[model samples]
Target: MQSTKLVETRGLTKRYPGVLALNGVDFDLEAGEVHVLFGENGAGKSTLISMLAGANSPTEGTITLNGQALAFSSVADAQRAGIYTVFQEFSLIPTLTVAENIFLGWEPMRGPFVDHRAMRRRAHDMFEELDFPIDPTAITASLSRAQQQMVEITKAFHGDLSVLILDEPTASLTDREVDHLFGFIASLKERGVGIIYISHRIQEFQRIADRVTVLRDGARIGTVAMAETDEHALVEMMTGRAITEIYPQIAHTPGDVLATAEGLVTSGVSAASLEIRAGEVLGIAGLVGSGKSRLFRAMMGLAPRLGGKVTLKGQDVTRAPTRAILKAGMYYLSPDRKAEGLDLAKTSNDNLALNLVMGGTGVSRMGFINWKEVRAESARIADYVELHAGYRPKLVSQLSGGNQQKVLFGKCFGQEADIYVFDEPTVGVDMGTRSALYRLIQQLAEAGKAVVVISSDLPEVLNLSHRMLVLAHGRISAELSGDEMVEELVLKHFFDESGAKA
Candidate 1:
C-alpha cells in the first residue's frame, strides 16, 4: 500500500499580468516527514507555498488533503482546516503584546468578553514547551528579529496543526535556538504532522529533511530522497549549472591601513580594536549578542561610541556624523536590510540612484536629479551585481529575497568609496547569489578597496577572510590569519571568557 499523503498539489499554476510565478508544479508531503522545497530566489518556492497557505489562489490545478479536494478562501480558512504557515515576512502586529498577537483572531472568550488572562497563560505555556525565552506581556516591536521569529513559531503552535509550512524559519536564529527548533520539529514529526520547509541554507537540509524538491524558473526540476543527494547535486539541480567553488579565492595583498578603531566602546560593544587595510578582506565573527556588528557600527558613527578613537586614512572621525563619514569615502551595509538598507516602496533603479545622489556622483545637478543619467548608471550597477534587468523598474519589495539583496549590493558600486563594510551580506540568499556576491567582494579587494565582512556564519567568514577576528562578549577574543583560521580554533574563541572582561 502507498504511504499516507498529508497534502498534495497537481498542475499548480500561478500567473500575473506579465509573469508566471509558478507553472504546472506537482508536489506532495507524506505524514511525519519533512519535505524541503529547495530553489534559488524567484524560482517559485514562495509562490507555491503562498498558494498552499491560502495567501494566494492558483489560476490552475487542484489541491487535496488526505485524497479529498479542498479549497481555502483565506489564511484563517487554512488554519481552521488544520494547516498553519509561518511566512518569511512576519504577520504579527508590532503595536500589540506578544500574547495578543499570538491569539489575535482566535482569542479565548468568557461569556461576552475576551479572556486575556487565559490567552497569556496559554502563550506562556507554549513558549515554555518550546524552550523559548520570551515574555508574553512584552511589546512585539521591542523584540529582536530572532525573538520575533520565535513568536511567529509560538503563534503557529497554538493551533491544531496537521500541516506546518515554515518559510526560512531559522534565518535570524542563533545556533542554540536552531537546536531547539530542530528538536521541536522532530517532536512534530513524531506526532505525524507533515512539514513543508523552505530555506536557502543547504547545510541544514540533512539535519531534518527526508525528501527534497528542486525548482528552477517556476518549474519543478525533480524530487529526490535526501539520503541519496549531496550538496553539489542539489545545487546543480537548483541552478542548472555546476558551482565548483562557492567562495572565490583572491590574492590578499595588504596595503596601508584604510580604517582603524582603538578602544571602541558602545552600548553592546566593549573595548574592541581592529584595523581594516586596503586590498584585503577583514572578517569579524561572533554569536548572537556578541557585539560583532556593534563594533563597526560604532566606528562608522551609526551607534553611540562612549569611548573610542576611529580614524579613516589618518583623519580622526571619532565624532563625525554618519553623513560626514559616508562623504569621507566609507560605506557600511547593514545586516537588517529590510529595516536599514533599501526603501521597499521604491523601484530598484530609484534606490540605486539615491545612493549615487548621496555620493555626489553627477546623478544630480544643483537641486534636480538627472533621470536619464540615473537610469543609465543604475542599469550598469545592476549588471555588475547580476540583478535582472526586468526587476529594475519594479519595487524592491516585489522582488525575491535574493534579488532584493542584489539591489542592496549594487548600491555599493553607485558610490566612490574606499572602504566597504558588509554585515551578514548573504543572510537569506541562495548559493548562486552567494557565489556572485563573493566574486564582487573579490573584485573590490583586487581593485585595492578596503573590505570588511561581519557575519554570524562561521564558515562564510572563514572561507572569505584574509584576516579573521573572533568576538566574544563585546570584545576581540582572537585574531587569526593564514593557517590559523580553522573551524575548531575559531569556535573555541567564540566563548573565550578572557575577552569578556574589559
Candidate 2:
C-alpha cells in the first residue's frame, strides 16, 4: 500500500524581532501514520503547528493538505479544512458542559433549535470510539486534568479531523490515563487520521510513532523511521548533544533547616509536611492535584490554609501573608508564567523592577525612581542568561518562550531570597536554556540559598535534588536520596501504595 501525504509545510519561516522561530524548515505528515515531532523547547514546534492550525501565520511558507495549498487566515479556516490542534494548555470552556464544549459553535440543529440531545449523544459516541471514561454531561470546570484532556480529544474526534495535533497531552495525565491515550492513538490511526504527537517523554515515540521528525534551533534536523532509532539517538538529534549525562550532579549538602511545614491541609491534600535546609535542593514530585501545588501555595500563603505550621528558619510564620513571606527573603516562581509570573503587557524593565518595588527596597524609598538602576539590573541579568535582544523596551509578550523564561528567572534572582521555590521553572523551555537554568540553580545553592523545586519531570528532580519527596493523594509517600534516584526507582513512588508497588 502507498502512503498518502495529508499535510506538508515547505520553507516555513517565522521571525520575531531577534529570534527566528522557524527558518526555512519543512515538515510532512501522512495519512494513517503517527508522526512524532521532537524538539528541545523553543525549536519552533509550537510556531509551526500554530501556523498549520491557523492560530498564527508564518512570515514565509507554503502549507498544503492533500496536495492543495491552504491558507488559514483564522482558526475557523483551519477547522473548515479538517485540521484540529489541542495545545498543552486546555482550551475548553470551563463553564460549559462536556457536550456543549465539544460541539460549541458547530452544533447540530433540529428545526431552528439547538439539538442538545443530539449533541450529547454525539459526544458520548466520540468517547466510546476512544474508549475513554468521561461523562458527557459533566461540567468541564469539575473535571480532573486527564478527564478534561479526554474532552479535548473527543472534540477533535467528533470534528472528523484529517489531521490532529496533540501537544504534551500526557504531561498532566496519570500512568493509566497515559496508557489509555496511547491505545486511543492507535485507534485513530486505524481510522486513517494523520496524528502529530508532541511530548518531552521520548519513551513514547517507540510505542506510538511510526516516524519521527526532529527540529533544532528552528530548523529540521532530520526525520527517521521509528523502527531504526533508539532514545539516545533521538536525544542526540533533537539536542545535538550526546546526552550521556541527563541530570546535573548535586554538589551542596543540606545545612540548617531553612523552611519547614507541618500539618498542612488544603482541598487537594492533607497532613502535608516537608523540610528544606539551606544549600539543599529539595524536590516535590506527584501527579496533578496530588497536593504539590496546594502545599506550595499554602507555604507561599496564596491558598486558604487549614491547620498548618509554616516556619522559616525556626520562626513561626504560619499566619504570614504572601507579602510577609516574600518580605522575609523567600520567593516563589509559579508554574504558570503567563497567568502568574509576568505582566505580559508591560515592558521587561517594568516586570523586573516590580520585584524590587514590591519589597520596598532603597530604590523605592528615595521618593524618586531611578530608571537606570532598573535598566542596569535587567540588562545585567539578561546578558548573564544570554538573552541576545535589543534594549528597545519590548513587552514580555513579544519575546520568545526561552527569553520570557529567562526574564522570569531574572526577577527571582534579583530578589536574593534565602529560600527559592521554583514550580516547573523549565516548563516549555529549550534544552540549552534548561542547562543554563540548572547551572544557575546549582550556583544559588553554592551561595548558601535553599532551593525547592516542584516538578513533574522525574529526570529533573533526580538530577538536581539532594533530597526528594513523592506525594500520592496529597501525602508524602516516599523519600529518595543518593542511590534511589533512577527513573524506575523514583517512578515506583508514583505508583506505589507505600513504597512497595512496582
Candidate 3:
C-alpha cells in the first residue's frame, strides 16, 4: 500500500542579498506520519518551513500538495490550502481574549457583528475536544505562557487541517503539559494529518517522530528512521564533530562560603536555605514552579522576599535592591533572555558594553563614554564566548537562538562578579552551543568563582554540579553530593512534600 504525500518540496532554495539561507533542500511529508526537522539554529530549518508556510517565497523551488504543483503567495493562501503553521514567536494579541485571538480574522458573525456567544462556545468545545484546560474568555495577556501556548495550538483546530507545523511548541510547557500535547499529536496522527515538528530537544524525537531529517549550513544532510538512529549520531551529524563529552568535567574545590540564603521565602518559594561557595558549581534541580528559580530570584531582590536573610561574604544584604546586589559582585543570568536579559533593538556589542558602562568599568570613565574601548572590550568578550566577530554589530534580535545566548553569556564577563547564577542557561540552544557554555561555566568555577546553576534538565544538573539540590513543593527536598546525585534518587526527591533530606 502506498501512502499519500501530503506536501513535497524539490530543490528548494532561498537566497538573501549576500547569503544563501537554504540551498537545494528536498523534503516531503506523508499523511498520518510525524516528520521531524532536526538541526542546529541557522541550519535552514526556519527558512525551509517559512517558505512552506508562505511566510516567504523561495528564490528557486517547487512545492506540490497531493501531487499538484502549487505556489502560495501569502500565509492566508497556505491556510486556505489546509496548511497551518504555529510559529515560535506567538502572534496572539495581548489585549484580546483567548477566543478572539484564536479566530481573529475569521470570526463567527451575526450580520457583520461578531457573535461572542457562538465564538466562546466553539472555543470551549475545541478546548474540550483537545482536553486542554484554558478559559476562552480569559485575556491572552493574563494567562500563563503554557496556557497561551495551548490557545495557539487550539487555533489550528478552527478549520480543516491537512498539514500542521509546530515550531518549538513544548518549549514553555511542563512535563504534564507536554504529555497532554503528545497525546493530542497522537490523535492528529490517527486522523491522517501530516505533522512537521521542529524542536531542539532531541530526546523527544524518539517518542513522537517516525522519520527525522537533518539539515546543516542550509543543506540537507540526510534523513533516517527515528528508531534506527541514536542521539549521539544525530548530534554528530548536526555538529560535524564527535562530541566525546557534552558536559565538561570541572575540579570541585570548595572554599569559604561566598553567598548564603537563610530561610528564603517568596510567593513561589516556601522556606529555602542554600550556600554558594567559591570554586564550586552548586546545581539546583526541580520541576517547573518548584521554587528552583524563585529562590535565587527572591534572594537577588528581583522578586519580593517575604522573609529571608541573604549574606554576601559574611555581610548581610537581605534588604538590598537588585542593583545594589549586582554592584556587590553577584551576576544573575535570567532564563527568559529575550524579555529580561537582552535588549532586542540593541546590537550585541552595545548590549555587552551597556553592562560595562553601568558598572563604571573600562568602557566608560567619569560619566563619559569611550567608544573605542567599548568596541575593543566587547569584541574580546564576544570572542571569549565563541561568538563570531561578524555578529557583534548586528542587533541581538537578528541573531539565532544560540548566538543570542552567547551574547547574553558575554555580558556576564563585563563586570568581574564573584558569584554567578545561571537559570536555564541552555534552554533553546543546540548541542554545540551547550558544550561551549558548559566549558565556560567550568572555567568560571575553576577560577575560584562561586557558581550556581538552576536548571530543569536533570542530566545537566546531575553531570555538572559537584553538589545538587532538589526542590519540591516550593522547598528544598534533598541535597545530594557524589554518589547521592544519581537520577533515581533525584527523581524520588522531586516529589517529596515534607521537604525531608534524602
Candidate 4:
C-alpha cells in the first residue's frame, strides 16, 4: 500500500441553471485506499464524480493529481489520465457482444482489420481474474442487468486505472455476486489504486471503506476514518439528522380480497397461490432471480404463462395482455425506473400523462388528442406526488433520481387503479424519499387500494407490508402475518431449504 494522495478536489462546484448541484467542496482519495463518498440523493455526489470523470465540467473547482493540476476536457481525457468511473446507468450498446463492448473504441487492430480473437482472449482473462462467469460472445442486451454491470466494470478496468469510481455498483447484484465484486475490489485496493465508492446502502461502507466522506446538500460535512466512525454516525452526518427508524410499523387493516392467483405457473414460477386484499400491503421477499418479478409480469400477461389463473375481484383474468390487465384496474410499477418505468428523454408532462393516455382519459372526442387536458391532469398528479420544481418543462433526465422516481409514481398514480404492484419501488431512493414512499403506500392502502410490494430490502418489506410472502426458486414457500413477519424469520424462509420447495 502506498501513502500518497492519488486525487484531490479543491473548491469543487457545479451549477445548473437554477440549481447549485455541488458547492465548493474539497475531497481527497489516497492511493491503495477505499474512500466512500456518502450522501443522500441530490446531495451532489453524482455531480462531483461526473466532474472528476470529465462527464461534466465543473463550474468552479480545481482537481489535482499527484500535486499537478489536471484539466480534463472530456471523458476520454480523464481516461487517458487513468481515471475511470462505473455509473449506475450502464452505457453498453445492446447489439454488441460482451467482449466487443469491453474493448469498444480501443480494440486491438492488425494492419487494416480488428483483432477479434485477441479482444475475446483479453476479456476472458479479465473475467477469469475476477472469477466472474460471463460468456464473452453473449450479446449485451441478452445479459441481465447484473451481468451488464460486470461488463461495465470490466471495461473500466481493461487497461490502466489510477482512480476508480463505482456508483451503486451492487444495486443489481445478488448476494453471491456482491461477494465476488467485493473480493475483486479488495485486490484493486491492495494494488495501490485509489477508489471512490458510492452507495446508498449504509451497511456496505463498513465492509469495504477505509475512510468515509459525508456530503449533504452539496457541501462536505467531514471525512472520517472508518474505524473512527460508525454507521449511525455516518447516517447522521450525511442526512444532517438521525434517521431514527427508516422503516416504520404501520397498522394496516386488510379488507376483502381484491386479487388472487390460484395454481399459477409462469415462465419463471409455478404452483403459486396468493391473494391481495384491499386496504392492505402484501410484501414479497426473495433473491434476485427467485421469480418474484416474473410472477407479477405473468399476472399481467407481460410474460408467457404456461398455466395459471389470475382473478381481480372475482373476474378470471387469465392469459390477458398487459393492456387488458391495466384496463382491469391493476397497474405494475417497474423496478427499473430509468429503463422501463419512465421515458427519460421525454418531457415531464408527456411521461406523467402516460397512464392517462393509455387509459383513454387523455383523449376528448373521436380519438382526438387533448394535450391541454392531459397537461392539466398531469399538473394535478405531479402536485399530488410533489414533483421536482413543480411541473417544469424539462426532460425527465434533468431531474434527480428521487424526483425521477416520483415522476414514475405520478405516471402510475394517474391510472387510479384498484390494485398497484410495486417491484423494488425504493431501490435507489434515498432515506427521506423512501420514508415518503412508505407513507404513500400506506395512504393507498388506507384509501382501500390493494398494494403488492416486492423488494430485496427485507426491513422495508417487513415494515411496509401487512402480510408477507417469501419466494425461493420461483415458488411461494412461506406466508407470514403479524408476529411472524420479523426480518430474521423472513430471511430464513427466503434462503432456507423450505423457500425452494414446492
The numbered model that scores best in TM-score is: 3
Tens-place lDDT digits, model 3, residues 368-470: 7877887788888899999998898899999999999999999999887999999999998988789999999999999999899999888788889999889
The clash tally of candidate 2 reads 0
Candidate 3: worst-modelled 10 consecutive residues by lDDT:
359-368
| Greater-TM-score candidate between 2 and 4 | 4
**Candidate closer to the true structure by lDDT (higher is better), 1 or 4:** 1
lDDT of 2 by residue, 347-386 (tens): 7767877876554443665577676776677677777666
- Which residue runs of candidate 3 sit more than 4 Å off their true CA positions? 363-365
Where is the poorest 10-residue window by lDDT in model 4? Answer: 493-502
- lDDT by residue (143-172, candidate 1, tens digit) is 987789888877777567899999999998
Overall local distance difference test of candidate 4: 0.85
Across 312-417, the per-residue lDDT of candidate 4 in tens digits comes to: 8898888678888898889999988887888888878888777788777768678987888888898887887777555448888987778887888888777669
Residue 490 miss distance in model 3 (angstroms): 1.7
Candidate 1 vs candidate 2: which has greater lDDT? 1
Candidate 4 backbone collisions, by pair: none
Q: Residue 119 of model 4: what lDDT?
A: 90
Off by over 4 Å in 2: 9-21, 54-64, 67-74, 89-100, 131-148, 157-160, 172-176, 244-247, 263-273, 362-367, 499-502
Worst 10 residues of 1 by lDDT: 358-367
